[model samples]
Target: MTRTFRRGGTGGAGGDLDLYQYAYLAGGGLRVAESAVVSLTERGTLSLGAARLRVTGEERPEHPVELAVVVACPRSKPVREVIESVGHSSEVDVIARRLVSLGLVRRWRRKPTRAGRRRLADAASAGQVPAYALRGPAALVPGSARRGPLDVHPALGDLGRALTRMGKALDDDRGHGTDSSADAGGFGGGGGDW
Candidate 1:
């Protein structure tokens, strides 16, 4: 479905996203690489060797991630190297751009847009996401992105706490605010803070 994105870039919810998009949602490009490995292994097109992944079948890859993995495994490369190669390949960029265009992922960063989160939730509920592909820190965090600057920058939460500390340190903790005339050392006075 066609989606029109708002200027702030949290994006609007439209419909379900694909498995690769879901992988991107959970763990960026690395997760996509892991997923391609699992798919290839399950299909018997790829076999794992001693510290390597060897192609056993002549099956042509159809997906970008799959193609990247297959192309990198021409001679049974190390498993780690193969995954890393595909993780950093142009194919991941292509997947990322498609997600960005669909409003499922933000540009530049690997963060899923708000609508993208909904798409992930949809996939989860439908059991479209393979359980083996998601776990640990890379797993999807439930709920919408935090509000305000925190939504745009996860690190901004720390800045917000710092601002609170500044307010408390000024004895403005009582909500006396800038008009308290308590003298904020000229750093936080004049209603500069919200």
Candidate 2:
């Protein structure tokens, strides 16, 4: 099984908040393995099965540069640029730290992958804002983020109607003599009444 890690940021004070999503694939298909929100300030190690990792985060001198370094990312880039790729830098750092703590991700001397870089590019292009990306003050609970369910997804609408009809039928069946009397009536009127 393979897993994916990701981060997102929010605006204002506390920097970015980090979050991760893990996907597990088996003979059936793909499914969500695990997901969580993490904090940026911490040092720890993680061990997932045979894999082991260590990570650390500390504030740096260069504003954006420091943030990137704390996340063990090489080179300097704007906060917006970082946010674009991984989400908020702070959030990403927190997630990285969490990975360290959880044993999912660790700090070590290793080269980045083309797939990882591509994932960053996709994150950037998606324009996934920070508010909904992280937890605590920054992250917005997905379901509560908007007013309510859209009820406009076509299939969902149909399902809603079907459920409504089913409910009405259930109510009718559960009622007293009214349903039985109604059923007894034939064509234009009841047999004896006609």
Candidate 3:
């Protein structure tokens, strides 16, 4: 048996909203078992376990930098450099603070050598920023292998279809002005809105 999944954006603020597709194949039998879309909007619909639900709430920032730091694990680069590299200039301090609070990264002062200390003293006299390293995770490194369930039961087809419908309806209600039904063919017409 083999399982396949695809992820894409659902078109919203910062293009952070996303949609997912899950399908399973076994002995030449192919079935789509799930379709879900999540957004940072006020109200949307979701299908879960034979239930169609209307969800409403504020979307919170997930601090995407944390993931970037994780992927760059074992490399403790400077915080300012990390922010610049990740293009999070405006939220640099906030993201750094959040990551430190979550224990995902550690900030530390670089030990100064004799010559480095002289330069630091000169820079301090000139009011330059202090240097710090944003460390990555200690236990789990990127590309580490892990295992989990491969497929959802074929019996959940109805639930999958329901979820697709809800997603389409929500998209339509948002006036995105695109027909996602045609795109979501395999999951019974609950395709995503780019």
Instruction: Choose the strongest candidate by TM-score.
Output: 1
**Each prediction's TM-score against the native?**
0.60, 0.18, 0.17
Candidate 2 ranges with C-alpha deviation above 4 Å: 1-88, 109-194
| lDDT score for candidate 2 against the true structure | 0.28
lDDT of each: 0.61, 0.28, 0.26
Please write out the lDDT profile of model 3 over residues 66-180, one tens digit for every residue. 2332232224333223323433322234433433343323444212234333332443344331111111110111211111114432333443344344334333443542645
lDDT, candidate 3, at 82: 32
Specify the poorest-scoring 10-residue window by lDDT in model 3: 21-30
Off by over 4 Å in 3: 1-96, 101-103, 107-152, 157-194
As a TM-score, model 3 comes out at: 0.17
Which candidate, 2 or 3, would have the higher TM-score against the true structure?
Answer: 2
Please identify model 1 stretches exceeding 4 Å from their true place.
1-16, 136-194
TM-score of 1: 0.60
Location of the lowest summed lDDT over 10 successive residues in candidate 1: 136-145
